[model samples]
Target: MSSEEQDPDYRFTLANERTFLAWIRTALALIAGGIAVVQFVPEFGIPGTRHGLSIVLTAGGGVLAALAVRRWQRVQAAMRRNEELPATRVPMLLGGGIFVVTLIVLVILVIWPPVGQ
Candidate 1:
């Protein structure tokens, strides 16, 4: 086996790939959530607010997917050079932000719904 292949650092690269996949899955879930909000909310004659919220969620998901790909590349490069892994708290922060926003939207949609069909 090649020296690099046998190197312990190569294991980090595998970990990076797994992390990338996890992010992609998260992005997909965000996208699905957005779609669900758009699809189901309107059935109850929800107001424009739901449409706006769905748009935001969809945009956030797309941005997250793009960022995940970029992060994966950076992690791969860092691994190849045996550098310290890049910090990853940003994704977690973004995820939490998304969750909070989604929850708020859901609560608003449920409690003080728009009047008239």
Candidate 2:
């Protein structure tokens, strides 16, 4: 309707919104994981490691939640403006963050093993 920007197709807009919601869900899961770890996971042999990991997970979730909104807005704007979609580092960020967390968890498990094992 605006001279500068036309509305994008409704389907595309809905798809973008769905993606945003998925990201939000993932973010919530991460934050819950952090809480679950602190509440249920056994303490790491290295002092403070469990707490540190929880903090990292919760913080990453918070950051991703913020970035999801930003990415959604940028994509919506680009679609309306008929501009090339913006490049996003979200995938790499999520992958690398998970990779690092997994590596840390692996190391902890190797060094300390599980309590029952």
Candidate 3:
């Protein structure tokens, strides 16, 4: 019998699916934030900093979005085959990206407050 033919628990499969959906949601939110930042945020401190943040966040979102799908597939396959799931690095990457973006925004706000607030 093929690996896929080996039936896994229904609950596990459903849980995996839910996790995948959650990741997609995260990606969408990040993309929206990026758009809002670039389009709505006023030009602050450095001229290009605003654009740079938007770009970095959007790119990070894109990377995570792709990895989310891939990770789902990978984990699903491992589950089906009854094999140990591989280590995941996505969480680290995602967290680091968020931290870096937050730092940049904080620095910008501190260094040069947006006037007329």
Give the range where candidate 3 is weakest over 10 consecutive residues by summed lDDT: 1-10
Which residue runs does candidate 3 get wrong by more than 4 Å? 1-5, 115-117
- State each model's CA lDDT, in order: 0.76, 0.91, 0.84
Q: Largest TM-score belongs to which candidate? A: 2
TM-score of 2: 0.93
lDDT of 1 by residue, 1-117 (tens): 445533445567788789888988888887888898788865333457767777777888888899899999877766666667688766677968878896886787677665553
Error of 2 at 42 (Å): 0.9
Query: In candidate 2, what are the lDDT values of residues 1-117, reduced to their tens digit?
Result: 579899999999999999999999999999999999899988877768888989988998999999999999999999999999999989998998899889989988898875666
- Tell me the TM-score of model 1: 0.75
Number of backbone-clashing residue pairs for each candidate, in the order shown? 0, 0, 0
Q: Candidate 2 — which residues are off by over 4 angstroms?
A: 114-117
Candidate 1 global CA lDDT score: 0.76
Ranking of all candidate structures by their TM-score, best first: 2, 3, 1
RMSD to native, candidate 3: 1.9
